[model samples]
Structures are given as C-alpha cells and as structure tokens.
Target chain A: MKYATMRIISGAGERTLATITEVRSIAALFLHALHGCFRPSRALSASFFAQISRQILYTGVEAMGLVGIIAFFCGVTIVLQSMTTMPQFGVTEYFGNILVVAVVREMGPFFTSLVVIGRSGAALAAHIGTMRVNKEIDALEVMGIDPVHFVVVPALAGMTLSMICLNCYFDMIAIVGGLVIANVTVQVPFGIFLGKVLDALSWIDIVLSSSKGLVFGAVIAVVSCWYGMAVNNIRAVPQAAIRAVVGSMTVTIILNIVATVGFYAR
Target chain B: MPVKLEIDGIFWSAGVFPLLRGISLTVERGEIMVIGGRSGCGKSILLEICAGLKRPERGRIVWDDIDIATMSRNELLTARQRIGYVFQQYALIANYSIFENIALPLRSRGDLAEKEIDVRVHTVMEEVALFNVEKHFPESLSNGQLRAAALARALVTDPEMLFLDEPVSGLDPQTASGIRAVLHARQRRRERTIVTICHDLYLWASRPHRVAVLEGGKLVEPEENHAFRQMVEARR
Candidate 1:
C-alpha cells in the first residue's frame, strides 16, 4: 500500500509538471507571435488588417446595443441609490461626480471586457479551436505561413482596438445618462453636475482605464487562441472555449483590482 | 520520371496505439501511388507523416534525397509548399470566399503581384471548372463544389506532389467521378506525383502506377498493381 501510494503521488506530480510545461510553451508561443506581428512581414500585415475589420464587427458593432442598455440602467440605478444616501449627507450635488468616477473610470471598462469575453472571446476560441482540430493550422504551416502571423496577430490587433473603442462609447453613454438622472431625480442643476463631473474626471483615470482595457483585450485574445490551438479533440473545443472565457474574466477582475490599487496608491 | 520520395522504416503512433509500424514505400515523379485499406488502417496517418504534418517516432522520409524527418519546423514548412494536401472534409476556409480560399497560399507566398495572384486564382478556378462559384463562400457550396474548390486551392501552389485523403468519401457517384476526372486531367497535364488514400479499389486500380496495401497498421506483401487488386478483391 505504501509503495502504491508513492507511485500514485509520483504519477500525479509528473502529470502536473507536464501540464505546467505545456502552459509555459503556449505562453511563449503567444509572446513570440506577439513580437512577430510588428516585424514588418507582408503576411502579418494582411492578416492584421483582416483581423481589424473582424474586431470592429465582433467587438464594437455587436456590443453597442447591450452596452447602451446596461449603461442606461447603471446610470438610473446609481442615481436612485445616491438620492437616498446623499440626502443623509447633505451633499446631493456630488452625485454626478460619484457616477462619473464609478461608471467611467471603473465600471465601464470592466463590464465591457466582461461582455466581450462572453460574446467575441468565446466565438474566437471556438472558431480557432475548430480550425486547429480540423488541421487548418497544420495546413497553414504546410503553406509556409505561420499561423500566428496569419491568424493570431490579426485577432489581437482587432480586439485591442475594439475594446478601447467600446469602452469609450460605454463611458460616453453612462456619463450622459448619469447627468440626466441627477437633473431629474435629485433636482440638481444639470450645469452644476456637468461642471463637477468634468472637474473630477482626471486624464490619469482615462489613461489607466484604457490601458487596462488594452491589457484585458490581449489576455482574452491570447487565452482563447492558446486554448483553441492546444485542444486535440473536437468535442473538447467548446469546453476549452468556455474555460478561456471564464479564466480571462477571472484574471481581468484580479488585474483590475491590482490596477485600481496601484493607481490610487499615491 | 524518377522516384522523388522514399520512406524507410517509418514508425508512428496515436497515443499508445501504434499507427504505422516500420512502413516503407516509394513514389516516382508523375506516378499515382494509391494506398488502399479499410478505415482506421493508418493510411491517412502515413500520408500526414509523408506530408510532414505529423512526426514519426522513428524513421526517415526522404524527398529528393533530403531527410524531411530531420528538418527544422520552418524548413519542413518550406518542404510542404512543394506538396499539396486535399483533406477528407475538403477543409475549405468556410468564412472565406472560394477565390480568397484559393488565393490564400499565393498571398502567403509573398512573391506574386496582385494581378498575378488574380490570374493564377482565376486559372486554377477555371481548371477545376469552379470559376462560376468563385465569389461564393464554402457554406454556400455543395459537396462537389467544395471538393473542387479545395482541389483548386491545393493545385494553385503548383506543388510537385499531391496528397489526397479520401477525396470522394462522402460524395455522390456523379460528383466523385467528376472529381476523379478533374484529378485525372491535372495528372495528365502536370505529371505530378499523387499519393491518395481510398477504400475504393476499382477507382484506384484504374489510375495508379503502384498500389500499397495497409492492414493492422502494417504494410502487407506484394505491392504491385495486380497483387493489390487481387488482395483487395479477396478481402471483399
């Protein structure tokens, strides 16, 4: 029994090591491909443009309706919650600033990344996973075109650009809705609320939030592509795609926390 | 034509199960070499190994005296450009238009001008008689059209060797015959070496310069045309 237990433990250790090695290799492949994208290759350029168009369609246009509705409701809810609390503090005028800081600086990029992970990220994984399973990656290699240059670079470029654009749209709508809500519900003057928001909104906040958006976009694209390429079985593609989305969302939230702390640490 | 490919003592496996065990074969340029076996007989695996898509556990695949098994990944890729592969499911990029699908390899080549790419794509599409459907996506195409588009994509590179995996597996007889005719025509025109996996013995026997039989992941004896037919008929 002692011998058997040791054998089992050793087997498990070896399996874990193999998994870690595979993950490391995949991460290396992603970074290598990321660098390869900027190396002035003609194949990479065509794929990059193709991916940019796809990203615009998948991440920006498809997301507008959902983001718009969510932003409106978020504004409305923040106003309702603030009206109840601000009266207690006698600082009802600060509602617009609060909404702008919460929604624009924090919530907008976070929720947009979440939505994209669910929609476009999952689709990207599924599409690429299917390609891998069907030996299209091998086909690309056979044609002397790196799959990273042809497939992955374009996707990363497109998603990064799209995420930034989507977050910008989300911020605009949420802030406008918040101002309208403050005017109607709190009876705060719209001009005063707008002035406070503009004063309170820092360029640092926008830059940090957009930077986070870009990082999250890269994480989502890389994770999905890695999962897609790593899967061997056709039935495993969906599971890999789901894992990519869930893993990316969880990592994004954690990174968001770290970024928030780092930004406000001073 | 001279022998352009030689496989010596190839060994491959799918996980724990050995797929190709000490398999060896050779193909001369302009020859059609048919590998006939029942499903799961490792014929496709052999083709993939030959095409440098799969690495073997042991053995050497020499293409014109170059040992492909020992080449670097990029070198293997460059070697692959000289070989065309027609996948079992046609494997046309579904999102791309038929023309774009054919144009993909050329774009990757980075050698052809836009006009030249267009001309090559058009000529190949015409050769496969798929010029009329060039603008359509793979989803819009029928099985026959899809296979032809795939063939056109494979042929556009002007590969010296073509590897086909069950090219007519799921097609209707009419469509299958049409594909075979297109392949036959191309063979007549270019004299390219063709390596194909098929269970349809009669179809293969009619065209092949040589036939190899694989059973239980091992090549059986007597690899001549007459012996191959007799063995297939005996199995039937």
Candidate 2:
C-alpha cells in the first residue's frame, strides 16, 4: 500500500513537472516569435512578409464565408429565442443587452477562434510537423536560419491579425443577422433595433472582444507551432495536427474563461 | 597547422543504449576528415554534434576556438553561417523549388541582391550538373538530382567548413564522380575544411583524406584495421 501510494504520487508529480516544462517552452517560443515580429533590426524581408501575407490569406480571407454563415445563424437563433421567451418576463427592452453580451463580448471571439483552430491550426501543425520529419527544419538550422524567426514569427503575426479581423467581422455579421431576424419576425423597427444595440454596446466590450481575439490567435499559433516543432517522425505528423487542434482549443477556451471572469467578476 | 574544428570527449546515447563514448578528434584547416562506420553506428550523430545540430551528452564542439556549447542561441546561429552541412537524406524543403532551396541561405543572409543570388545559384547548379530542374520541387526530382541539389545548397554559401553526411552513398558512378569533382574544384580554389561520414571507405582511396572508423562507441585510425590493410595491399 505504501509503495503503491508513492508510485501514484510520483507519477502525478512527474506529470505536473512535464506540463510545467511544456508551458515554459511554449512561452519561450512565443516571446522569441514576438521579438522577431517587432524587432526592426531584424526587419522582415520582402519574402518573410510575403509568407505572413500568405498565412493571413489562408487563415483570414479564406475563412470569411464559413464565419459569416455561422455568425448569421447564431445571431438569428439567439434573437429569435430572446424574442419568444423574454416577453414573459417583460424584459423585451433587454434584447439588445442580451445580444451585446452574448454575441459581441463572448461568442464572437470564441466561435471565430474555434473556426480558426479547426481550419488553420491543424493545417499549420501538420505542415510544420512534416517539415520537421523531413529534416527541413534541421536544414534551415544548418544554414543558420532561425526556424523561430523564419517559420513561427510570420505564423504568429498572421494568425493574430486574422483572429482580430475575423472576430470583428463575425460580430458585425451576427448583429446584422439579429437585426434582420428581429425586423422580419416581429416587425421591430430597424432604427429602434440599431439604437438599442448601439446604446448597450460600449468601448469596453469592443476592447474585450478584440483582446480575446488577439490572445486566442497567439495561443493557437504558439500551440500549433510548438506541437509541430516537437514532432520527430512521419508517424507523428497527424498526431501533431490533432494535438495542435486540441491544445489550441483548450488554451483558447481557458483564456476566454479567465478574460471573462477577470473583467466581469463582481 | 591551425585547428578549424575540434570534438572533445563526446558522449551520446539513445534511450538506455549509449552510442558514442568519449569520442574526440581534431581537423586542421583545409583538411578533409572522413568518418566511417556500419549502419546504425553513431557516425552521423557525431557529425551532427560537430556541426552543432544535436547536442551530445558530454562534449565540447569548438569551431575556430569558439565553444559552440557555450555560445548564445543567436551567437550559435551566426556561427553556423560559416559552416555548411549536407544531410544524408537530402533534406530539401518540399515546398520550395530547386532554385529557391539553393537560394535560401543567401536570401536569409539578406546581403546579396536577387540578381547576384540568381547568378550564384545557377553557378552552383552548373557545378553540380543539375540542369533544367530549377523550378522542380524535391518530390519531383530523382535521387541523384536531389543529392546534387542538396550539395549545391550547401556549397552556394561558400562556407568555411563543410559537414557532409553520406554525400555519395547512393549515387551512380557518374553522379558520384561529378560530386567528387565539385568538391575537388572547391578544394582547389580554396582550402575549405571538410568532415564527411561515408560508409564506403574505398571511395576515399583516390583522395587525400584521413579516415577514422567508428566502432564500439569509439573512433580509431583506419590503418589499424585488417580490412583497411587488405584493401591497401589489394590496391598495391
């Protein structure tokens, strides 16, 4: 009994240490990538910027349609549900407040991040994992190319920018969907709905949403790239992709909860 | 003679099995050192350690008197720029075309204009006899072409020290001879220090190089081997 208890305790301790080590590694990689992005002395070459632009094109521009559809449906469902249910409580005037709280402050960044993680995060991890397996990363290092500066920085910058933009776009489209649904179902005046939304929205909501987007983007980029770089063989490529997706989603959701609680906690 | 590269008291292991044990060597400037070992030996790992690619369990890798193990990350990267390495697997970036792969090091240096890079890449390509494959990706190239392309990339920078891992292991005589000629020409032009891992020791008979065979987790002069002596006698 004593030996078994010691073994379990040791295993738990080992796992904790491993998790801490992994987190430290991710933080170091993130800081290095951030330094590369902002350092003018290491001014991004035209080619490097082109890489960043390509990442944005894939992660942001290409994701617009899916985000639009999801956001619209989400907004319609929430508004319809509110219209039907809130009248019982005589809280109809709070529709705009509900919409602002749910769509802008929370759902916009969270759902968009999920989409990005599903679409780009997995792909980034697989791409980088394949590069690692093929010794391409070693080749770059042998040629004196810092893989962090070359691969991670552009990805980090691009993903962060994409998340910010996509989050904003998602918010707008969902709000539009809400307006359309409200007008069509209950004949709510467009001006009145718009005024209510505007009245309830504040700069803090916008800042919080954008902040979530930025943090989630960095989380996905760092996590995906970290898993990818950790890959050692071809068999690990798909595993890396799966781990990246899971890791990105886990971290993003955790950050989402923390951000929400930190700002809104009473 | 001044030492250009030194490996001192190197030790490495994979899992529970130790691979290299207390291996040490010194290569003088402008000299070629060939490391030979059978399959599964730690020759490539030793070369990688010497090139600062993989850290050994216990060792000092000094390049031009600067201990690589002690250098900062950026310092090590900058130091690596003066060294070139050709992997046994011909590790060309799959997403890049042959021209782009050859031009990557130069582009990363951010020193030369595109035209100069173009000229240099083309020149090295010609030296390696890789023609009409500039736009081809690694997946599209044949084995010989891939090897030559890898060699071209390593040589394009004109690094002071070259580390080649099985540079000519799986090449036809023509391709292998062409590669040898390119290395010879480079050596003739400038006395670049080279360290190579080759399984076939017979290939080095025609060239002036020092051979060290890795066996039992240690390096020994090839002259002490019976097979080497028989090969030498047969040649005579």
Candidate 3:
C-alpha cells in the first residue's frame, strides 16, 4: 500500500512538471507569433489575411447559432430560478440586477469561450499536431516561413474577434430571453424589464466582458497551438486535442475569476 | 549567383544513437551532387542540416563563406530565402491550390505584385510540365503530378540552390524520367546548384557531377566523379 501510494505521488509530481513545461512553451509560442505579426511582410501577406478570414468564418460565423441558443436558454433558466426563489425571500425586486450582472458579466464570456474551446480549439490542436508529425512544420521552416505566423496568428485574431462579437450578441439575446420570461410569466411589462436591465448594466460591464472574451480567445489560441505543435506521433494528436481543450478552458475560467474579483473587489 | 556550399566535419545524433559522424563535403557552384545511402543512414538528416532547418551537433556549414550555424535569426531567414528545399512527401499545404502553393515563396517576400507572381509561377509550372491543374489541391494530385508541383514550388522563386530528398523514389519510371528531364533542364537553364538524396542508384541515367555515399555515419566520395569524367572523356 505504501509503495502504491508513493508511485501515485511520484506520477502526480511528474504530471505537474509536465504541465508547467507546457504552459511555458505555450506562452513562448504566443509571444513569438505576436512578434511575427509585427513584421509587415508577414502581417500583410495575402496568405495571412486569407487564414484570418477562414478562422473568423469557422470560429465566429459558424458558432453564432449555438452561442445564441445556449445564451437564451441560460437566461430563461436563471430568470425562472430567481423568480421562484427570490419571491420567497422577498428580494424579488433585485432579480433584474441579478440577471444583468450574471448574464452580461459572466455567462456571456464563459459560455461563448466554452463553445469555441469545444468546437475550434480541439480542431486547431488536431490540425497542427498532424502537420507536426507529417514534417509540414519542417517544410515551412525550410521555406523560410515561420509556422507560428502561418498558423497561430490568424487563429488568435479570429478567436478574439469572434469572441468579442459573440459575447455582445449573447448578452443582447440573453436579455431578450429574460424580458420574454418577465412579460409572459411574471406579468411585468416588456418595457419595465428592458429598462431595469439597461439600468443595471453599465459601460463598465461591456468593457469588462469584452476584455474577458479577448483574453479567453487568446488563451484558447495559444494553448491549442502549443499542444498541436507538440505532437510527434499519431497517438499524440488525440492527446494534444484533449490537453488543448482542458488547458484553454482552465485558463479561461481562472482569468474569468481573477477578472471578476479584480473588477468587483472593493 | 550560385554560391559555394561547404559541410565541414558535421556530426549529429539521435539521442545516444549517432547518425552522422564527421561527414564533410563541398558542393561547387552550378553543379549537382547526389548523396545515396541505405534507409536510416542519415541522408535526410544531412539534407535538413544543410538546409539550416536542423543544426548539427558539431560542425560548421559555410554558405558562401558565412557559417550558417552562427547566423542570427534574420540572417538565417535571409540565407534560407536564396535556397529551395523539396521534401520527399511533397509537403504542399493540403488546403491550398497548386497555384497558391507554387506562389507561396514569392508571396512571402511581400514585394512582388500579383501580376509578377502570376507570371513567375506560371512560367515555372510550364517548366515543370504542369498545366491546367493549378486549381487542384495536393490531395487530388497524382504522385507524379504532386512531385512536379513540389519541384515547381521550389523553383518558382528562382532560388540559387535546390535540395531534394528522394524526389523520384516513389514514381513510375516514365514519370521519374520526366522529373529528371525537367530537373536537368532547369539546372542547365538557371545554373542552379543542386543536391539530391537518392536511395536507388540505377535511375541516374544522366549521372550527377559527383556521387557521395553516406555509410558508417560518414560521407564517402566514391572517386566516381573523376573516374566517370575520365571514362566519358575517353569515349568522346
């Protein structure tokens, strides 16, 4: 039993070290890719622009419906739960504020990032991992092209741009869902619900939420790119995908927490 | 101008396993040298090291009197820009059309107008005997056509030097000969220095200027270049 316990501990320590190494590599790749973009030749290339457009279409345009549906349902559920529980506590007057704060500040960024992590982050890792194993990265290097410039920058730009737009859209639609619930179930006027939500929301909320979306998008791109370029075998591709998704999601959640506390901690 | 390339006492290893030991060679301007070896004999590794994609553990690769190993990042990029490398697997971007793949090197320079890029790429395509397949992706190409496209991409920039790894190893005889003919024509026309890694020796109907063999982790010149030249001169 003692031997087994020691083995488990050792394994966990090795895993922790490996995770740190991975994070360092991802951060390095992110910085290098950003540096690559500062060179006008790389940043202004038709290939780079084309890659950005494709990524936008994939991560932003294709995922719009999924983000909307999830946001609307999330809003409706929160409103319903608050309506039932808050009235018993006689705090129902604060429901509009609760919904506005939660949906706009938290749910909007969290849900949109989760969608991109699942849909695009995994795909990014898998694609890059396959290319690494196949010597495509080596091919690029020999051709005097940095793979980071060709692969990661566009992904970074696409995810950030998409997430910011999607978060705003999610917030808007989610409020509509809450207004719908307010009008039909609670017998409140649509104008009242809209006015209350608008009152509770501030430019600060948009700024905070947009910043969260941008940071989360960058996290996903860097983590995905790092894992993807780390593969050496066929088995490693699936492993890379899993790690990329988990790492990006973890980073996003941690960033969300810190941002939340930093904004509200008075 | 075609620059002189020198590989001086290069040593490389894979973990504890030594792959290349004290391998040295000199490739003169406007000449072709084919390095032949068995499987896993570090043929590709040597090519990659010479291309500046991989650094040798111990040795200096002097390209036109500048040691590539000590060059800065931008210097390395500048050096690589003057050379073209063709991988055995073609390595064409699967999502890109043939025209785009061929135009990639030119596009990366960021100075060529679209018309210049189109003209140079099409001219190289014609040189490689590839026509009307510009819109097709790499996945849709035949083995021979893919090899042609790879060669076209390598030559489209009019690089001063060209390196190919197992370029014709997997193609049919007719297609293999066709590729060889195109390579020879390009070399003669452009005076581009060429280094090829080959597994099969029987296919060299038009033998290169020199033949070097990688064996026992060292590059050995067969003295065939001198002997073959003498024999040809004797015949003439």
Candidate 4:
C-alpha cells in the first residue's frame, strides 16, 4: 500500500514538474524574442520584415470574415437579450454599459484570440515544428544565427499588431450589427444608440480592451513558437500544434481572468 | 587564416548505448582531415561536437585552445561564425530562394553590406559550378545542385575551418568530381582547414592530408584509405 501510494505521488509530482518546466521555457523564449526586437542588427534583418508581413497577412487579415460573422451575431443577440431582460429591473439605460463591458472590453479581444488561435496558431506551430524536425533550426544555430531572433520575434510582433487592429474592426462591425438590429426591432434611433455607446466608453475601457488584445496576441505567438520548436521528430509535429493551441487558449483565458479581477476588484 | 581543432578524450552516449568513447584527434591548420567508419559509428556526432553544436559528456573540444565546452554562448556563436558545417541532408531552408540561402550566413552576421553579400555569394556560386538558378527554390534544384548550393553557402562566409558531412554521397560521378575539384581548389587557394565525413572511397579523389576511422568509439589513425578500410574491418 505504501509503495503504491508513493508511486502515485511521484507520478503526480513528475507531471507537475513537467508543467513548470514547460512554462519556464515558454517565458524564457518570450523574453529572448522580445530582446531580439531591440537588437538593431537582428531587428533590421530583411527576414524579420518579411516574416512579420507574412504573419500579419496570414493571421490577422485572413481571419476577418470569421471574426465579423461571430461579432455581428454576438452583438445583436446580447443587445436583444438585454432589452428583453433588463426592463424588469428598470435598468434599460444600463444596456450600453452592459454592451461596453461584455463586447468591447472582453469579447472583442477574447473572441479574436480564439479565432486567431484556431486559424494561425496551429499553422505557426506546425511550420516551426516542421522546421525543427528538418534540422533547419540546427542549421541556423550552426551558422551563428539565433533562431528566436530570426524566427520567433517576427511572429510575435505581427500577431500583436494584428490582434490590436482586429479588435478594433471587431468592435466596429459588432456595433453596426447591433444598431441594425435595434433599428429593425424596437426602433432605437441610430443617433441615440451611437451616443449611448460613446458615453459608455471611457478611455480606460479602450485602454483595457487594447491591452487584452496585445497581451493575448503575445501569448499565442510565444506559446505556439515554444511548442513548435520543441518538436524533435516528424511524429511530434502535430502534437506540437495541439499543445500550442491548448497553451494559447490557457494563457488567453488566464489573462482575461486576471484583467477581470484587477478591474472589478478596484 | 586556418584554424586548429583538437578533440580530446571525447566520450558521449545515447540512452544506454555508448556512441563515442575517449575519441581524440587533432586537425592541424590547412590540413584536410577525413573521418570514416560504418553507419552509426558516431562520425557525424564527432563532427557536430567539434563544431560546438553538441557538447560531449566527457571531453574538451579545444578550437584553437579555447575549450568550446566552457565558452559562453556568445563566444561559441563567435567561434561558430568562423567555422562552416555542411549538413549531410543539405538542410537549406525550403522557404528561401537559392540566392537567399547562399546569402544567409553573411546576412545573419549583419556586418556585410548587401552589395558585399551579393558579390561573395556570386563568387562562391561560380566556384561551386552552380549558375543561373539563383532565384530557383531548393525543391526545384537537383540533389547535386542543392549540395553545391549548401557548400556555396558554407564557403560564402569565408570560414577558416570547413566541415562537410557526406557532401558528395548522393551525386553522380561527374558532379561529385566537380565538387571535389572545387574543394581542392579552395583548400589550396584559401589555405582553409577541412574536415570531411565520407562513406565513399571514390569521393576522396584528391586525398586528404590525414585519414582516420571511427570504430568502437575511438579515432583510429590510418596511414592511407586502404588502411582506413582495414581499421574498420578490424573493429567490426
């Protein structure tokens, strides 16, 4: 009985140790990639520029349609649901506040991250993982090149830039969709709805939403890169992608939780 | 300027198997050293260790008296910049064009101007007898062409010590001869130190200055290619 108990305890300890090691490695890679951005020689390399442009196009611009459809439906449904429910509490004027908090401050960045992770994060992991398996990373190291600088920084920068832009686009489309729904059903005046949205949004709200976008973007990039480059063989490539997607999702939700507690606690 | 590489008391293992045991050798400046043995004899691992890409469990790789095992990351990188390693698989980035591939090492060093990169790459390309495929992708090039491109990239950096692992293994005889000719010309012209891992005896058209065989995890010094074969058989 003691031996079996000890075995189980050691197994749990081993898993916990693995998780900690993985997280530390990811954080270290993230810092190294960030440092690469400040090194003028590496930052100014043409490869960096090309990779960033490609990543933005692939991750951000290509994700617009899915984000648009989801945002539109989400906005209309939330507003309609609020109109039906909030009248009982006589809090109809708080519709704008609810929308601002739920959509702009939270859903915009969070949903965009989900979509980006599904679409681009997997690809990034698979691509880098394939490179690792092919010994291309080894080749770079042998040639005196830092793979994180050459490979990871551009992905990190591009995803962050794209997330910020996509969040804004998501918010704009969701508002337009909500306004259309309002005009069609309860005949809320376009000017009144617009005024309410504007009134509900403080600079702090905008800053918080944008912060979510930036942090979530960096999280996805770093997580994907860390998992991708960790792959050692062809069989491990798909596993890396799955691990990256899960890791990115975890980081995104964790950041969201922290932001929520931080803002609401005060 | 040529470089000296000394592999001293090298010992390495994989899992439960010992791959290298007390292997040691010295490649003098401007000397061409060729290492050979059977498959899985740790020839490639030794090459990687010598290049500081892999650290031995128990040994010191003294590249010009600086123990790479103890060198800082930046120092190791600086040391690697002066040594070029040609992978057996050619290992070119499939995403980059041939021109870009050849220009990679110089570009990564971040010291050469674009014009200088272009000139150096083109010169090496000519020397390797590869032409007019600068914009072509690696997949489009023939195997021999890809090997030539890999060699060109290695040489474009003007590394003092060149390490080629099975560089001419998959090439036709004529192409292999051409590759050997370029290596010979470069060795004499630049006085570069070279270490090659080869499987084919015919690939050594221009005999290396020193030939050694790796068997039973030790460097077996052979007087000639014929003797190298005897050493391999003796170990097996």
TM-score of chain B of 4: 0.92
lDDT of 1 by residue, B1-236 (tens): 32388898999888899888899888888889888877787888899888888878899989989998778877876677788889887777767788888898888778888899899999988877785888898889888788888888898988888899888888888778877887877788889888888877677666888877787777774354455667667867
Best-performing candidate as measured by lDDT: 2
Q: Which is the leading candidate under DockQ?
A: 2
What is the TM-score of model 2 when looking only at chain B?
0.96
Model 4 stretches astray by more than 4 angstroms: A42-44, B222-236
Considering chain A alone, report the TM-score of candidate 3 relative to the true chain A: 0.92
Model 4, span B1-236: residue lDDT tens: 89998988999998789999998899999999988888898999899888888889998999888888888987777778898889988889988999999999998887878998889999999989999999999999999999999999899888999999998897998888898888888889989999999876435634788878787888776543465566456655
Write the number of the candidate with greater DockQ, choosing between 2 and 3: 2
Candidate 1 per-residue C-alpha lDDT over A1-266 given as tens digits, one digit per residue, 9 for 90 to 100:
99999999999999999878866875786796688667746744564576679777987788999988888878778777887888799886677678877887799889899988998888888888898887778777767777877777777878888888888888878877877887786577878877887887888878977898888888888877777877777998998889889867877899899988887796
Better of 3 and 4 by TM-score: 4
* Fnat of each candidate: 0.45, 0.70, 0.43, 0.55
The CAPRI classification for model 2 reads as medium
True contacts kept of 2: 0.70
Error of 2 at B141 (Å): 1.9
Candidate 3 vs candidate 4: which has greater DockQ? 4
My TM-score estimates for the predictions, one after another, are 0.90, 0.94, 0.92, 0.95
Report residue A35 deviation for candidate 3 (angstroms): 3.0
Candidate 2, residues A195-236, lDDT tens digits: the string is 999999999999999999999999999999999999998999
Worst 10 residues of 4 chain A by lDDT: A36-45
Q: lDDT by residue for model 4 over A1-266, one digit each (tens)?
A: 99999999999999999999999999999998988877735523798888799999999999999999999998898789988999999888877887888899989999999999999999999999999877788888899888888789999999999999999889888888888888889999999998998899899989999999999999999999999999988999999999999999998998899999999999
Candidate 3 residue lDDT tens string, A1-266: 99999999999999999888877888898888778656635424788888888999999999999999998988898889889999899887777788878898999999999999999999999999988877778777777877888888888888789889989989988988888887789798988888878888889988998999889988998899889988988899999999999989989989999999898895
Chain B TM-score of every predicted model = 0.89, 0.96, 0.91, 0.92
